[model samples]
Target: MNHQTRLQALSAFLKAQRAKILPDSVGFTSGNRRRTPGLRREEVAQLAGVSPTWYTWLEQGRDIRVSTSVLDCIATALQLTIDERKYLYALAQESGSGATLLKEQLPEISPSLKRILHELRFCPTIITDRRYYIVGWNEAASHVFLDFEQIPSEQRNMIRLLFTRKELQRLAVNWEHFTKGFLAIFRAYYGQYVEDEWYERFLDEMKAVHPDFNILWQQSDVQSAPEVLIEFRHSKAGKMLFHLTSLQVQGSTDLRCSIYTPVPDSSTEYKLKQLIERK
Candidate 1:
């Protein structure tokens, strides 16, 4: 897109985002005389610590040099999602970095990675793309988690399943805690792929169906891949606990391989064996 088009897009995005935030949500009273849906440009300027005229010029798509710090302040004022924040940066043409791979350019799983997952017979292992779509899995993963083969290609996302899949939710002993942490990592990835529209669509669809997702997303929590202990109560296997660890796939920046290892002193290993045997 050309410079003018980018500016117009940024203007529209800022307006749309500004419309989503209620004045009362950001410590302003909803006076009866309001004609707009959300906080006014002046209110946003106050929150962002920018001049009202300058902010108005930005919303008007005027040619202005937006510094990174100013963009971040505007993002904070608008309460944009990670995806929305990154898209704002892209639209403003502020990202000075070189070209990076989009999600569409994600490479296929190498044979070595496939073999590694296969050999991890006892561990429930799955490889996911930047968007948390389950792209690779082993037999253990199929048994421990729901069978990825049975899930439709579009519904193979980990966050989608976490919220929409009733069985998985019921199985997770600490569903809220686990989901929150997982969502934080997803937030990190969501911010990187500014060119991908799929992230925005997926986020909207998820928030539409799950109110909790909307609430959690608004928290704006972000974390690097952290080791987590997850406990599950399978219908057949009963109580099981596993430590989840993530590793970046070699030669691929957009792929992550996560392995679920049985926690020490837990019956998880024995239970996984039984679960796999019945599979």
Candidate 2:
């Protein structure tokens, strides 16, 4: 979407949201016979702690600048969902040119890279681009997680799977912790391409498919990929632990390889071996 189109859409979305909220919903009494069903523009501005004229101009789709803090206030006043808030930010801030650039520089994995993944016999390994798209994985990875080959190419994002895939969620021993950590890592990477159309679309799809994702996203936490001790409750192995490590591919700046090694002095190694054999 272009800048003008985004502004128009943003205007329409804000108006629609404002129309859905009743005066009583924001701590005001419905004292008089209402001319409209929802709060008026001035009333919304007051609730959001912004100047009435400023808010009016925003609703009017004037070429006005909006800060993230102000947007956060407006989101809270309007009770916008995480997805809605993200959409609002995209419409307000994204230039759309970054999407074109990103597309031109899309990451690729070679056959040798796939072979390397397969060669990691004891460790469950997977390769992803900066956007967390699952480009490749090993047999051990398939044994630990779902087989990426079985999933549609477009739906192979790690963050997407974390939210939408029930099996993965079930396997997580601490789902909330794992998801929060994952989201933080994603958020950190997203900072580099906040205005990209692909990122916007991905965020939109995630919010649409998983409402819970929005909640975590709103936290605005930033974190790099960390080597952490993670546990999973495998259906066959019962329980297993691994030390997760994320390393960037040497030549491909955008590509990252994540490996999960069994913790020392645990039955995780034996369990992983058995799991791989069963597969």
Candidate 3:
């Protein structure tokens, strides 16, 4: 296909994927009469840091230059996987083929890795990539987070839910800990990637709804915590204390897995016993 044809295809792919957004999913309210898809074009434009007019042109595949920096920004706005991100860069290429950043393939986790975690059933374990997609999990992991499998793969992003989904806010018993991750995840994106329209677009959207976000955005300091101790009221496990563990990917160093350990010999253990027995 011609370069223009290629760009249009990729751009259309992104729009189709994004148009399924729910207003509350992105921290907006869809009025009754608004007949647009998930989020409006303006919402995506506002969040992605392009003008409605310019971004519309992009969706239409106008001959405007699509820079690598812009693609990185768009990638963040769309919450793309590293593989998906590389595809974006390839399509954004001006003339010919270009190197796609990030790994070609992430090495498969050894069978030993799964077996080791399986033995520690009380230690809630989950393997998630940079995109925060759950890749692996143990029973404990299932107990800690509710309805994980029920969530659509695209909507699994923690940051999107933290700000948009009401159920998540309620489910995440440790709001502070989760909020910190949200801050760190977005901050890391900003640090490794370029400053683009997407940054401003999210900021503006958050500012419209959450003043605290605006305050934090201005400070520009985000902390990443490897170990998290939090309490959750699980449907099956009941109220439990968990010690969270996070490990970064070895080769790409982009993926992360987190395991939450139940506190030793506590009432939480008793509660878990009672709940599991009842089932």
Assess every candidate by TM-score: 0.66, 0.63, 0.49
Task: Give the candidate number with the greatest lDDT.
Answer: 1
State which candidate, 1 or 2, has the greater lDDT: 1
**Model 3, range 69-159, lDDT digits (tens) per residue?**
7777777776666645654565555432222222233335657778967887666677765434455666655555544677765555555
Ranking by TM-score: 1, 2, 3
Q: Per-residue lDDT for 1-279 in model 2, tens only?
A: 445656665677678778888888788877787787788889889999999999999988888989999999998888877656665676676622343335344467888887888778889998887788887888988888998899987778899899878889999899888888777667545544445556667778888888888887764344556778999999888899999998878783567888999999999999999988875
Look at candidate 3 and give me any clashing residue pairs: 21-38, 48-197, 48-198, 49-197
lDDT of each: 0.79, 0.78, 0.60
Deviation from native of the Cα of residue 100 in model 3, angstroms: 5.7
Q: Report lDDT (Cα) of residue 43, candidate 1.
A: 96
Off by over 4 Å in 1: 1-107
Worst 10 residues of 2 by lDDT: 95-104
